[model samples]
Target: DQQVKQNSPSLSVQEGRISILNCDYTNSMFDYFLWYKKYPAEGPTFLISISSIKDKNEDGRFTVFLNKSAKHLSLHIVPSQPGDSAVYFCAARPGSQGNLIFGKGTKLSVKP
Candidate 1:
């Protein structure tokens, strides 16, 4: 069974707008949440991440928020640009030493 799930298959946002991507997980043991962005054939690039100890984390234009009670997490991109268009994968780690479990990914299309 898939532990992580990205309900939306795709998302489209206009340039300069805020883009929100959501993810949910079934495992309560997960201690870390990570977001990765992939551009076509290239590998997925690490975006932002949040530890279970914290509710939010921010890095430049990217932000990640975790709601442990709900077993949900979301990634926010402010002033999204066309260059930000990519497939976003949501991943979670069960513990410090555990491998990450990834969602199917949601393709984001930022239109100019």
Candidate 2:
């Protein structure tokens, strides 16, 4: 079974609205979670991250929330803009390894 999963294959939002993405994990060993935004032909770039120790971490309009007990996490982007349209990936790293397990990204379309 995949350790990480993004149930929604895609999401759409109007510019200046909020975009919410969800993710789930099966591995309890994961300690660090991260979100990445990817553009076509380009590699995924880091967006936001949160540790299992914290329930929430925010960076400006991007925020990551982790629910350790439920093995779930989510990313929220406020004021979504057309430029923000891209694939959003959810990743997790086990406490002992540097390798990250990534979910099949959720494509986000921010319509103008």
C-alpha TM-scores of all predictions: 0.98, 0.96
Across residues 2-111, which tens digit of lDDT does each residue of candidate 1 receive? 89999999999999999999999999999999999999999999999999999999999999999999999999999899999999999999999999999999999999
Clashing pairs in 2: none
Residue range with the least summed lDDT across 10 consecutive positions in model 1: 44-53
Candidate 2 TM-score over all chains jointly = 0.96
Candidate 2 accuracy as lDDT: 0.94
Runs of candidate 2 with Cα error greater than 4 angstroms are: none
Per-residue alpha-carbon lDDT of candidate 2 for residues 41-68, written as tens digits (9 for 90 to 100): 9999999989889999999999888998
Candidate number achieving the greatest TM-score relative to the actual structure: 1
